[model samples]
Target chain A: MYKVKVYVTLKESVIDPAGAAATKEFKNSDYPEVEQVRVGKYIELTIGDTSKNVEEAVHDMCKNLLVNTEVEDYRFEIEEAAAK
Target chain B: MYKVKVYVTLKESVIDPAGAAATKEFKNSDYPEVEQVRVGKYIELTIGDTSKNVEEAVHDMCKNLLVNTEVEDYRFEIEEAAAK
Candidate 1:
């Protein structure tokens, strides 16, 4: 089995209103030093097979559905799991 | 200034109901091979100062407000940005 990790985040130039709101809330709660906040999403998947075909399929899923490539940028890494 | 990256995730033993729902939805959209999805949160903060006091304040904010230490696990890294 292999573990896949994906990180999805807004394009660097895009404004993140939600992130700003969270930052505002945090600052108001006595932590006034927080300068800025940018929020993103993380996803993990465990694939049962380690075949090349499976890896290609997973990549296709990430490209077409798992991430909105137009508005978001995503990066993924696949790693071998320790023997269980 | 320094950049702080924080990753917050549900404990390994906890059930991720939202992640499961997202996986189900993705599978229903013709991507049947997607086995599972575990969702987490990522936060990035840009602190205006790199002083030890500033770093300590950022750590405290992360511990008390940025992440729910009870149900979530978080890790952070600080990096110096390329001079612009």
Candidate 2:
């Protein structure tokens, strides 16, 4: 089994209103030191068993549905998942 | 400056409907090998100069606003950010 960690964020060229809002909120609060904030989706998947290469499988997943490639950028990492 | 990477995940006991829906979609699609999918929020923050410890500052941010302690769990990593 493999544990896949995916991070999906809006492309730099795109403006992130949600991220901007969060940053403003943080700055207004006690954390004025926070200069910038970006928000995105984090996905974790547990692959039971597979003959295909883990990297390839994850890449396919990301490209297909995990990310909106046109406006979002995604990256993933695979780790040996512990047995249940 | 510091770059903080945060991962917010729903507690294991919490049911993730979105994740379930995505998993079903993947199974119906070309990637049946995807057994289970879980989804959550990913946040990246850039912290400017501060006299306080980075860890403490980040922990405060997480506790105060980042992670919803009621149903979510969060963890963060800090790295020296490159100068812009």
Candidate 3:
């Protein structure tokens, strides 16, 4: 089996309200040192098969469909293991 | 300044459609080894001040507004430095 890890984040230039809120709260509550906050996503997947062909297929899927390349970035890893 | 890291994920029982789709794509593309995909979010924040009171405030902000405790988990660290 293989494991795939994906990370997603907003474009750096984009305004992150959630992050902003966190920053504001931090400052207001006395944590004035907080400079900025950025939020993103992470994904992990376990695959069933352990073969080069299978890994290639999974990579393509992540590039074309699983990730929104326009705004998100992702990376994946593969591992071999006995079926579970 | 302080750094806050937040991780948000679907509850174990919750279904993740995005993860499912990624899995299906992996299998269909010939990467059948992919077993599953679980996606989550991550956040990082940098704070400006380095004081015990400030750290406490930032921690509370993260707990109360930065993260959805029901579906998210978070941790933070504090650092001392000259203002930049």
Best by TM-score: 2
Rank ordering of all candidates by DockQ, starting from the highest: 2, 1, 3
lDDT of 2 by residue, A1-84 (tens): 888999999998999998999999998999999999999999998887778888987888899888999999999889987768
**Could you arrange the candidates by TM-score from highest to lowest?**
2, 1, 3
Model 1 global lDDT (CA atoms, 0 to 1): 0.77
Better of 2 and 3 by lDDT: 2
**Model 2, residue B29: C-alpha shift (Å):** 1.3
Residue B10 lDDT (model 1)? 91
Q: Judged by DockQ relative to the true structure, which candidate is superior, 1 or 3? A: 1
Q: What fraction of the native alpha-carbon contacts across the interface, defined at 8 angstroms, is recovered by model 3?
A: 0.87
What lDDT, from 0 to 1, does candidate 3 have?
A: 0.66
Model 2 residue B80 lDDT score: 95
**Ten-residue segment with the worst summed lDDT in candidate 2 chain B?**
B26-35
TM-score of every model versus the real structure? 0.83, 0.95, 0.66
Off by over 4 Å in 1: A26-33, A53-55, B26-33, B53-55, B82-84
Q: DockQ score for model 1, please?
A: 0.64
For candidate 1, the chain B TM-score comes to 0.79
